[model samples]
Target: MGVLESILRKDGRKFMKRKDSDAGEPGRALEELRGSLYSDFHTSDGAKRQQQRLCGPFVAMTFNFIVAVGIIMANKVVMGMVGFNFPIALSLIHYLTSWFLMAIFKALSLLPASPPSKTTPFSSIFLLGAVMALATGLANVSLQHNSVGFYQMAKIAVTPTIVLAEFMLFSKKVSIQKVITLAVVSIGVAVATVTDLEFNVFGACVALAWIVPSAINKILWSNLQQTGNWTALALMWKTSPITIFFFMSLMPLLDPPGVLSFNWNSNNLFAIVISALFGFLLQWSGALALGATSATSHVVLGQFKTCVIMLGGYIFFNSDPGIVSLSGAVVALCGMSFYTYLNLLGSKESATTSNKLLSKQNSFSQKPKTAEDDVKVEVNTLSSV
Candidate 1:
């Protein structure tokens, strides 16, 4: 009986050890998996950052395209087809709505709160706001006076204007390839859109006048983003109030005399509200795109948006696109594609250079002690001892 009891106790101990080993096997496997995952994540950090950088421009471009198309369609329906014909008044409503929306976003803490700018004064912000208001208001006026095709042609000018302004004002250098791309895009837009070059002197003047301020506004927005560390929302919030004030002051002067006499209906009211909403979105998206990329890229995106809108017009409004238009669009697309490829190549090269630098830095920081270092350490230790 004593031998049997001892044997049972030994068996029990063996079973407990077996159970402990089983548990530890899973824990060791889990630890190995965790280590593998951590190593992968650490190694891919640079690639992840590159992907994020690429995604910024992509997201910004998409937002700009969608909001721009919506605004263009809404504006056409409201001002041209519906005969609301009050561009400045519409702009005023847009600014007001934008300010209200920005305020709501801030109140809800949906956007990060940016402290007031130390480098950029409030006066500079207000001036930028005024320029933006003027540029957009004049653009609307130009659209009212010009045909859709002509308006799009005028828009094509903006890219070159911005590029030229950057070169002249900031001494910024654009690659020859990019410059050629811009030229191709401009020519394509002109061929695709300009069917009948209807020259309204007033419209021409307004379009030309807006170009300078529009260019300046884009550059200023980019600068402010870098210098002020401002997000799209924060910049818009700061500028919206001044824009609203400017629009209010200009509306009375610039709106057509018949604006007050227009018949009020549910359709008009709905269109106005929708237009205002789209306008707000346009401003927000445009700011985001400009903040994410350069002014030149923003202008290129505008050209792309024009191409899409032209296609949309053909499909939805039965606006016949000629063979020339189709060919021009293809050319424009090719140019944009080539430009994108160049940008990607540039980005990859930059990332590779950065990685090389980082590796060198790490090697330098983690370098092993030399023989001289060891000798000095031994001498110091011996003296202390």
Candidate 2:
């Protein structure tokens, strides 16, 4: 998966070239779509700003968590009439549709967007994009079998997961504060994971499938974004095509077509179409955030997402979080906060500087001026004097 991430970076140059060329007209539609979603669904105004700032990722994850519950409930109702499970079908359908839409968008980009230098090739990016899609798709699949709150707990687990990834892969040393934080987050996972006892065995197993890629993708996508290798949306959008291809290949072998073919009612259809758009937004925003920061920090901060969703679940369903869940959440949140604070403090810039050493280097690079300019200025000054 890491190698695949490394390979996808090569395609970023090509993707960026396409993005620049299409900035004028044909590209306007997707930009418009992204802008509309950001404004209407993402950005919060007025008093909500602080709420938005405090738990940035939480708002989005809550939206996703709610949608997951909605989809499951909707699927149950719809399946009653259609006599088939849509969730199973959706595991493949969502990717299939999203990728196809992206491919068409890519085609349209060719019409108006200018092409970039030929140095970047398609194969390089295709592999990385494929890795991204696989990671994202399996993560989504985890939600199908797991309850929102349970899945959310697993989501919180991604923090320590990434920390471990960094430690093992990058040889980073852990501090005492960091170790304590990890312990707190681990406790939260225990509370959240233990409660869904009826079917948790399966839910947890599926969630682990997601956790590995989620952590890897977080770290990989972060670096890819830092180096300007790929714009955030393009990485996820491009992979949709490859994801579709892979899903399509595997679905028939695993699930039946009769499972997908359904009685299309207006309401259920609306639900799915809406979910698809949200899915895109979720992936894009997530990629944007990861690309903007260190993956380790990004994952650690993302713990808030699970907290919000768990709280929201309690409100919506009147589901009791109980003592264990509450304690776990607090501990996990504190750990993440402590870890983030230490990292930020350590990275702070110092005021002291020695610019005198730079003076010679600056003087050596200067442009030459005529000596007469000195005489001219001197004569002018004498006349003024």
Candidate 3:
């Protein structure tokens, strides 16, 4: 009986040990499964967040670059090759098409709703739209009168023009480095204009006429976005109608009578329609870039576009902008690039200064208030009283 009782106790102990081991296996498997799931979720979430962070600026820049270059080439073909001599009319078509597209985007919930009228005043929007019309109109006129290379070279003047305008109008101060760079840019543009075989007085005057309005337009666009938190599409939607009105009013005055009699054949229609579509994309992408970046960055992108467009003109359009003109463009580009760098550096310095001030204030607030501080405050209050 003693031996049997000992045997039963030993078997019971063995059975209990086996049961404990079996229970642990399931828990171990469950923990492993949970760890695997957590790792996968962490990896996927990190990748998605990274993509979202990068997508905006990358897409904006790429969109601006491709459409900007393509639109210029397409417009050159339409205006120069297809003999679409009415610059104002062409601009009108572009604005109208853009407005229609914006409407569709609004309906589809792709674009944000227009801001409240009180927040974005009609007068300001109207002014921007009018200036936009004048800027685009003069651009087309300049393109119509000038070779593609010369037109693009003239656009480089806008950077310096913007700098001067800001200083004069808003008391904005630029660094000496930026001033020197802008001077270089101006000299380079003058050299290119002088050397350009295709340069005519009217074309040059029109190109020169374009610079101020263009500068103002860009400044206003940048200001509106940064200060008012305006999205590009929303701003465009509000301003397009004003632009259209300006275009319509200018059409009769500027566009010649032959528009009605001009042949609207399939080829011509197709070319013009395509050019107009590119025009809409140009406005959208340009606004996207300006909003995503800054006026300075936009100008830098424009400088890059200038280089590509000039090269494209030489290659595709058989433009013989002599070695001197090309050299001038190179000088201007180098100057513009330097100016952009200086601006960026200055911005970073300012940002750092502001951050330091904020940190100091935060640190002071976090510290426990001492009796001396309270005494000083009380003293000041009594003194004021």
Candidate 4:
């Protein structure tokens, strides 16, 4: 009887041990599965975030390009082809349309509002507004006087102008490579657009005059963005009203002959409305593009837009873009591409250096001095004394 009891006890123990092992196996397998899923989820999430970061700027740039092209084409049709012939009035219509759109956005709470700046004086805002008005007005006059291709070619100078303004106003230094790139772009533009047969001295003057204010306006916008933490819409809202006021004040001096004498028709009215809408879209998209990317990126995109406009002018306006002009445009675009590559390389190096410094700082901050280390330091100091 004792031997049988021993055998039963031994068998029961073995059975219980096997049951426990079986349960443990499933539990460990479940934990491993959960860990693998968690790791995969994190990996995919990080990849998605990276994609979104790249896609956002790309989308903004593309939108700005399309909108800019549409606006230029529309303006060329209205002011150049349709004989609206009212540059100031046309500019006024643009601002009014922009203001109306902004008002609508504000009412719907779709526009992001920025807090008012205590340090920024009203005069500064007025000055920015005046510059905006003058830049747009002069650009329109230039466009009216020049062929579309020549007008776009003239805009190639804007990049170098901005670079020059930065150097003069902010004491910023550009690299020799960048300077060479700028020279190449300028030379190419001169070759493409500046022909004695097609060039009007007045138009060239208008374009050159437009460059200074445009550069200053961009610098001011960038400054306001960094210092005031203002969004694109907020900046637009603040400046649009002042811009409208300035345009109205200047209308008397700048308006064309017999402002109210032209016969108004549905086709002309439709063209005016379309041009105004395109103008508003141009401003909004341009602001958003600048907000999404840097000024350099904006300028690079501008070069691309100029190329597109130049092509469009050939197709739509029947502008004679000679071999020299086409070659010049290609050269200017290549220089811009080179400049962009250098800028990107510099930015990457700067970011890497910054990251390394940040990591060193974090590591230094993490290591606190222990009591023993403090005692050793004090002892060393006393011994040295």
| Winner by TM-score | 1
Please give, for residues 106-197, the per-residue lDDT of candidate 3 as tens digits. Answer: 67756654445777677889889999998998887887788865776667678777777777866777777766787786666555545454
Candidate 1 vs candidate 2, lDDT winner: 1
**Residue range 160-250, candidate 4, lDDT tens digits:** 7787777887787888998888788677766766654355898878877888887777777666654555656677888999899888887
List the candidate 3 regions with Cα displacement exceeding 4 Å. Answer: 1-62, 146-157, 192-194, 197-208, 292-300, 311-320, 367-385
By TM-score, the better pick of 1 and 4 is 1
Worst 10 residues of 3 by lDDT: 43-52
Q: Could you give the C-alpha RMSD of every candidate to the true structure, in order shown?
A: 8.5, 16.3, 10.6, 10.4
Candidate lDDT values, in order: 0.80, 0.60, 0.77, 0.76
**Candidate 1: segments with Cα more than 4 A from true spot:** 1-55, 312-319, 367-385
C-alpha lDDT (0 to 100) for residue 261 of candidate 2: 55
Candidate 1, position 268, lDDT: 87
What lDDT does model 3 reach? Answer: 0.77
Sort the candidates on lDDT, descending order.
1, 3, 4, 2
Of the candidates shown, which would achieve the greatest lDDT relative to the real structure?
1
Error of 1 at 287 (Å): 1.0
TM-score of each: 0.78, 0.61, 0.73, 0.75
- Clash-forming residue pairs, model 3: none
